[model samples]
Target: MKMTPHENTKQFPALAPGPPRMFAPQTSTAVSRPKKNSTACLACKAAKRKCSGPDAPCKACRSTNTECHFDPSRDLRRKVAVKRTIQELTNHKDLLESLLSTLGSADQLQFDKVMDLIRKKAPFQDIAHAVGSPATTFGDPQELSNASKLAILEYGENHIETSGNGVRRPSDPGNIASSPEEIPNMKPPQWPTVSPYARVTLESLCDIPLFEVPAKPWTKVTDDDYLVSHLVSLYFTWDHPCTQFLDQRIFLQHMKLGDRRSEFCTPLLVNSLLSMASTYSDSPDVFSTPENVFSRGQNFFHEAQKLWEVEDDDHDLPNIQALLLMCCVFKCQGRVKKSWMMLSQAVRLAQDIGLFDTPAVSKKKMLPEMERVRTITAWGVFNMSSQMSIELQKIAPLEYPTSDVKLCGNEDFDWTPYPRSNKITYDKKPARLPEVREGLAELTRTLVDVQNLVSEKRRGTNLDELWRKAQDPFDRLTAWLQRWPSVPEIQPNPVPQVLLLRIKCLQAIIHLFEILNDPHQPQSVRQARFYQVKSVEETAQCLRIHRQSYGLKHIPSQIVDAIQTGLRILVPQLEESDESRQAFAELCRFGTALSHRFMQTADVIHEIRKNALHLGVRLPPEVIAIFDDPEQWRSLEP
Candidate 1:
């Protein structure tokens, strides 16, 4: 090192001289360290040392020869857990709030008990029971909306108490149930007078009251449970099968039990049904003043209206059922405008209750009974609304439900016949009512399609456009016919009620074919003629079944309408074909026989007679004899 300057100067000078004096870019003395890592290993962080990355071994850990590990979500897990805890607490708080709000009107003792149970962390069922909502099981808020505590309390408080199966007892036994002064306030009759025999029949048959009726002001006009029961039996035997709305088993069971609190039974519903049933009864109490035939069931109608008036906040299944019955009552009373209005109201209310949206209910599980009620009521609304619309010559207000809600289970068998009535028998067992309803519903949907096509044609849609639109419904009709089961030439002992539904389908087919073969349009004459012939043949089969199964009086009023419509449609062929003439005669006989029962039928018969006279076709002697002989009609009365 001491001689470096001179000795190194000579060697350096020799090297510089060889390559011309470049100092090789002055290399630095400092060394670069491994890049620092933001996400460091546990060991590296503890040691306050930088890490290169999250590789198998970081720079600091590798130098120290220590194990390294990292928690990827350590920071986030704590915050997430805190948030979930907050949400759970919030839900519990909401539940308490809703419970308190629902039970605001409860007595202090019960409310305090509920509050204490909540404080002591008791089960929701115990708390709900403490608050007098035995049906309540705390779940989602939507469950509360279905049956509120207030509704149950109001229903229990306002309705008259039922003592047993015999008679309904009033809440205040000391109070006089009837008022003599109220009779003066009653309105006069609106329609034509009744025959004197109408009032005398019931009075002559049973002078003494058979059984006690409900001790209510509305029901005082006819205080006989035996008569009421008979009327109810008649309704179930005839009208119930056609509408098939109520759960007969459950309803009759509750009715027999006199359980007013039961959801399936309500005073309004019972009275409304009685009002509808009166049309088939000969009871004098059914008449408003023992003289007005058109005022039949007026007392029960008023009772139903009064009960409905008191039902302010509640809109449960019974309300809808009662409203439907009320609509029918109005139609029977010849108040078409009111019936239409009531039907519209029912449809709106049904939608509001989410009965129409069955799919939405699946997410929030409903009780079996409630779900069944909703499904059947949905179908009822659809059927009734569709029929009313068809009658009024308007489009259907509701579409068919698309949800997979099912019919009642098979365990809900045919209802037991009313105990005192001998109308229903094993040998004359009709088709299952549900099957007939389903068939009618499907047929009504097809009819709706035909109606829409007819409406389009009325709007003057071009022929090609109309034909193109018609294909889907036409094909559907054909497929429906293909799917229809064949009827035996001789229906077993008593013809099933399902024959009527088949006849209705045939009528629909005929109507659709008529539309397709409209004279103004290019006609599919051969196809139309084939269906027309088929319809007549099917109708004849139906007539044969009816003749074999039961008397003309037992045939449904709907069948009478069908027969008249068919006759009117075939009037042109009457002069040419012997078969047509025979059908015309037979249909007239049927129309005249039923005409005594229905006012519209009488009017229809008169119009049909006028049309026949215009066509120079004379009425059959048998049909004329039916109109001339009062004894014939009197015997036909039920």
Candidate 2:
């Protein structure tokens, strides 16, 4: 307060402010501190504590009285190791691509050779050489370990086709492509695909269960997987066209996948199929003993029977199939009564499953192929029961199925050529079209009505009423014949069902005339004597077709029943003329020729002889000789 302005300015000159100097306000902002670059000591790193620096004992270690340690080579970030791993993976991927390209361009023979070597568990170097790779490329011992090579060989061995000698040979050169130049010219293999109506087939195949022969269910039939495969294949080749109740593709797919839980295949069904197919196989194991041809397939039949008795699902599709096949086995073995009973049970089960109902009303959801199978199976039961009823002169247990199921065509099924043996050429499968089944079903339905009419006649129904009832069925049959013209001759035609249907129609027509021209109830519709003449003429025509037909052994078993019916009508006319007797004898000889293979045909010959004697009709010496020869009718194996 006392000092002057000049003296105060001189004393505090350093603190003197400039004229109107402006200062900005300072605001506090939270800024994070930068991370330290110094590495931690071993003790600090292990404890996950902060360190001062790498000069000596770090602050953390010094505080804890621990020694400080650090290795310059240690990479705490692991960046170098990650980079090495990525490089190795890239190299491995490149190697796989190169190998795949080389293999993709190899011819089939060369590919097969390489695969064979791999299956033999050859060294990786040898395999690489076989695949046409340069020795130096994969020559490093560390590239492929022996264990890795063995693993690859194990995978290859599982898929290779090993021979009976337990060695896999290279594929036949003749069967493989010749030159790599032809690769561009090669066409894709033509495999069967699902029809438009059966779009669900591909899905069904994908849903198939894995195949395991050693699994519990399959072991109940046989331990040998090959035996099961062979028998199943033979059934499709020989017996499938005869009935076709089961869908071959679906059934085989289930078997191939080895899923025992699949609804399509079961031990009962497989064993039953084996029983039926055993009749056609030449294997000694199919027989109970070498001396007993009659015992053929008995082992499989017994196993199937045991399964059938224990089967829990009475309404299942495969169960119904097993029952039907069992019926056929009984028929083949000449157990007519047992066959009829089994057929009755199968019909009842099919009904219980509501197979006769429309798919919309069905309780169980199904695949398209399974729906087709059910439809076909329903028709099969009806046709089979109706046929047996006519042949046995009894009433059919099952009625016509009312479901609006579309009949399947050949395209609905797999017609892959079947291999019979180790033969190079496969047996050509015959065409079994749905049209044949349609015609047969139409013809069979009419015959069933006619059969009912015959039964009523035997029960002492009014002749006029019976004849009036017969007119409708007779007209229906006549119309059926015109729609399906009879085959002129039985050459080696593929569609034998056509010829077989014609024969059945002719047989029914003959029966229709027999009822119309009954001596007790005569009508003015046609001459009674002409009925006998016409019947004989048609019967002679059937005999001629049967005698000349090539590959009679391969025809459907139902054809045998048709022949039996024709023979029954013709046997009574033997005494009418010598020419008739000679023709009958010739047919008998031809039939006996097939009897050794088809036991049912032999039963038919014996029944004809028994019926002839019952009718007191005298046979010629040659006809009697044909019947008397034990070799002709002997069911025992040769």
Candidate 3:
């Protein structure tokens, strides 16, 4: 029943039979299969369109700015998840509110405190991890006062554990210690004739054989362990100023046991410390039997000297520390030249060991404790150097922080005290002992510059030039005073010798004033006199504090001489009348009494008074009192 081409089309079931019109139906082109969509997104698949638009904003959804690549089904699931999360967050907020309502006020405060501690610890913990530093536990309330900038640095150091190089440095017993034959920058005394006492005193330190200070080996010392313990305790408490780094805990720990490791401390160090202790001890148990105790101290010092001369051990830290401590003993006993000689060697020795390395270089190579210990020890040496320079009327050999070896740690200047660990940890904050010594040393450095300026006669340095040169140092001193703590109980345990620091600062101030050399202007003279009196008052205040805390019996001869020298300068400057004479008389009387208390200092005063008289300076009646009525002065009590 197929229809023909055209004639039979009508006969065949109408037009339905013939082939469909070619144009209307289109030629049966090959069916083009669509390629897979390049952008595979749920949106493109749902719409069944080719998404020509780039990643997120496909052309298919451009009008709505919809995520054309997003899967709607997955989007519904994400929406549900986001809603669930928001609901959970809202529920958590409500729970927090409920907790707040239930918690006590105290608990709330505790929670806040805990949060604060965590906040404080977080950044520091990150830093500690990077630097490989130990972090200090942040719990102390007092530590809060320190400025935040400092807290970051301080916390790391507070927890550091210092390990040693494990090298033991003991001075050989057979080696004789070298004595300083000449002091650099020191001018020999120009005297008409040497005083009997000055000559003898000098000999006692230099001419050891003449004084019969027999060489006693440290092991051969008197076996009175009780006395040694008492003396060592006394030194740590009273005399270890500028020498506090040789750890007392470790030292005592080792002292308690017979098997002390060689790396800890040498016999020379022990003898020197013990010697210094006995020298500074005013306890009746030690001092009542003066000859035996004092002699033993000298003998121990001689043993140290024997060890100090050992060339092989010149690089030893303990030996250097021993020498530094021995200088205090010499100073205590009025052997200043001997002290200067020994201290000069120590300064050189320290420089040799690269103690002056810059902070950046030093930190990378050292563990925490060794760096700190070296710093403190270096400070102690620098302090002694400054003190001696001032005493000798010369410039310090070691410069201040101007060197490449910059001081490090606590840059925020956290003055708050950390817990004392009995032994030294380099990073310990509020290191009061070192700080106090450092204060005086810093002050003394300023004084040294001024003293050197005033003492210079070769270039004929005029007073006007000196005054011009002095303004900066004076400004620095003022700044130091403004920054220094007046009440020095910054650290509570094992009270630092702050009074000693105060005394030194005052002495330095007095020396600064002494350089003015009796200016002609009345206003200038009045101000100078006022400052002189102020300096004396400060000295007296410090001495009073020191006496209350530690008895004056062990007070160094240097202190007595300093006071005497201050009085001597002040007495001549008062109004040239009745009140002036009385003040001068009182000062002379006081100075004489002080000298009598420390007999060795009397000799120093005698030399000073003689020098003053020899220079044709008119002597007052009060000045005549000590020299004319020697017995009268000797009979008086301080």
lDDT of each model, Cα atoms only?
Answer: 0.62, 0.61, 0.52
Candidate 1 residue 579 C-alpha distance from true site, Å: 2.9
lDDT by residue for model 3 (78-158), tens: 334334333333333333332343233333543463356456764432222121111212222332323222433433233
After superposition, candidate 2 runs with Cα above 4 Å error:
1-230, 357-365, 405-430, 489-492, 510-549, 552-555, 575-579, 597-604, 607-638
lDDT of 2 by residue, 385-489 (tens): 887777677776466675443544454433332332222343354445466567667777787788888678889897778768878987887788677755454
How big is the positional error of residue 11 in model 2, measured in Å on the Cα after superposition? 99
* Candidates in descending lDDT order: 1, 2, 3
Q: Any idea how many clashes model 3 has?
A: 2
Clashes of 1: 0
Best by TM-score: 1
Q: CA shift at 3, candidate 3, in angstroms?
A: 99
Worst 10 contiguous positions by lDDT, candidate 3 = 207-216
Q: Give the TM-score of candidate 3.
A: 0.51
lDDT of 1 by residue, 140-232 (tens): 444333323433454445434346673444476434225446556645324343334354433344433222334232244466667776677
RMSD of 2: 32.5
| TM-scores for the candidates | 0.60, 0.57, 0.51
